[model samples]
Target: MHPYLQIMIGFARSGVLGYGGGPSVIPLIEYEAVKNYKWMNSDEFGETLALANTLPGPIATKMAAYIGYKVKGPLGAIVAVTAHILPSLIALIGILTFFYSFRSSPFISGMVQGVTPVIAVMLFMMALDFLKKGSKGLGVRWAMILAVFAFLLLQILTLHPGIVIAIFLTSAFIFATYRGRKTMKQNFEQESREKVQ
Candidate 1:
């Protein structure tokens, strides 16, 4: 198959199989792009995800565009994005048609019920991957701890994630600045000692 076609198929599979939207799609994309195709490494995938999250568009689309650009430039980006959406587009229509055709059927409802667990599992796996990757060292590990605590508080205690994320960012910035200054001062002292010698 053509490269573009293959890329398209990969994305379509991702869309069709991915459960919980953009975040959920990451693992699928990583599987295809990193594990299967050897297009990038885990670190590159992390960077791509960060860039995607930082930008304004949908995460899945952002990834599709990036991967597509890597493989085939502008046209590839377009093709990948279109393919990523195509499955959902078709699926939505099919679902609607089924609902209309079987409005009274318990079978359709039961299928929906059955799929919910699968979606939950997929989302859980994705979350685990993020946690494993994001918590790199002691500092980041602590950061992850704080982040997760904040998230749990938000979810269970009716706090907001925005506030938690803001706090994390503020704390990180301050800590980084302090650490940077401390390192610089230490370096300066070492240089002065050498000069005296």
Candidate 2:
């Protein structure tokens, strides 16, 4: 099939089936982008996700646009974002009255309850995968500590997520710069010693 059609189908599936809003839709998008299409690897997807979180607007649309642009450029981005949102738009318009009528029904409530745990588990698994990758760079102990610190900042202090992300990004930049300079200096010093000997 053509790439555009594939993009349409992939994003449409994510948009339509993604219950519980943006956060829940992320794993579905990841599956399509990383596993199914092979557009990017997990690491790339994780990095894109982090960057996307730092930006405003809906996460799913941002991801769709990025993946589309990567695949087929500007037109592809337009197609991808449209596909992602169209289903939800049509469904909302078609079912708004029906949903409102049954919103308080036991059947509807039970369905929501059943789906909630599944969404939670999906999110947990995704986080675990990211944590494993993060541990490789940060070390397991530091990874756990940072995870707990993030949790406290988010849950206890009620800090905004964007602020927390900014703090971490700034720290990572500083640490990486320092480490690079240190490595360069050590290499230079070692070469000088060898020349003198």
Candidate 3:
């Protein structure tokens, strides 16, 4: 099949099957892009996921757009975002209607209860994979520190995740840019001194 079609079908499939919400859907998207199609390696997918989290809207949609653009540019992005959203939108409308009618249904309630454990496990495994990737790129110590910091922010302090993320992004960017400029200035000074000698 063509690459563009793969983008549509992959995201559409994920949208259709993505139970719970955006976070739960990540493993599905990762599987579609990384495992099933070989569209990107795990590290590339991890980087995309990180970037997607920083964006304003839904993570899955952002990832779909990125993958589409990577493969086929603007039109591909449009196709991917549309396909990714369409299934969930339609399903939501239909489910809302049905659920309103069957709000007291024990089977539906039981199904939801049954799926909770599976979703938890999936999320845990995905988090582990991401942690491993982070460790590889940032070193184990920094990765552990980040994980501990995130846990304290969300679990203990009860801060909004967005606020925590904003703090981290802001500080990391400012410090990295400052350090880069400082290193460049030192290098330039050293070169000038050598030239004077």
Candidate 4:
């Protein structure tokens, strides 16, 4: 099939099936991008997700645009974002009046309550997958430390997520630069010692 059609189907499935909101839609998007379309692997998806989070606006659309552009070009980005949001937009428009009428009904309340856990589980699983991959790169100890620190910032201190992400990103950059310089210095020292010997 054509790439555009594939993009439409993948994003449409994510947009339509994804309940709750942007966060909830993320796992579905990951499935489409990583698992279904083979557009990227899990690690690449995670990196893209991190980059998207640092940006403003809705994440799902941002991811859609990025993936689409990667696959095709500017036009692909447009198609991908439209495909991802249009389904949800049309559904909301069609159901808004009906949903508003029954917003307070017990049946509606129960339905939401039932689905809440499912969304939570999906998010939790995704988090775990990210953590597992992070541990592989940073070691389990460092990954756990960062995770705890992030949790404290987000849940306890109630810092905005964007702020927390910025802090971590800056720290990682500094750490990487320092480590690189240190390694180079060590290699230089080793070479000098070998020459003296």
Best by TM-score: 2
Q: Summarize candidate 2's per-residue lDDT along 1-197 as a digit string, tens digits.
A: 89999899999999998998788999999999999988899999998898888889999999999999999999999999999999988997887778788988999889889999999999999999999999999999999999999999989999988788888999999999999999999999999999999
Residue-level lDDT of model 4, residues 38-115, one tens digit each, is 999999999899989989999999999999999889999999999999988999898887889999899989988999
Candidate 3 lDDT over residue span 1-197, tens digit each: 99888988999999888898789889999999999989899999987887677678888888989998988899999999999999899999998898989889998899899999998999999999989987986899999999999999989999866678778778889989999999999999999999999
Clashes of 2: 0
Give the Cα lDDT of each candidate. 0.80, 0.93, 0.89, 0.94
Rank candidates, lDDT, best first. 4, 2, 3, 1
User: How good is model 1 by TM-score?
Assistant: 0.77
Q: How far is 77's C-alpha from truth in model 2 (Å)?
A: 1.3
Is 1 or 3 the stronger prediction by lDDT? 3
* Candidate with best lDDT: 4
Model 2 alpha-carbon miss at residue 9, Å: 0.7
C-alpha-based local distance difference test score of model 4: 0.94
What TM-score would you give candidate 4 relative to the actual structure?
0.95
Write the residue-wise lDDT of candidate 1 on 32-92 in tens digits. Answer: 8888777788888876876566567688889999998998899989999999998898898
Looking at model 2, residue 172 earns an lDDT score of 94
lDDT of 1: 0.80
Better of 2 and 3 by TM-score: 2
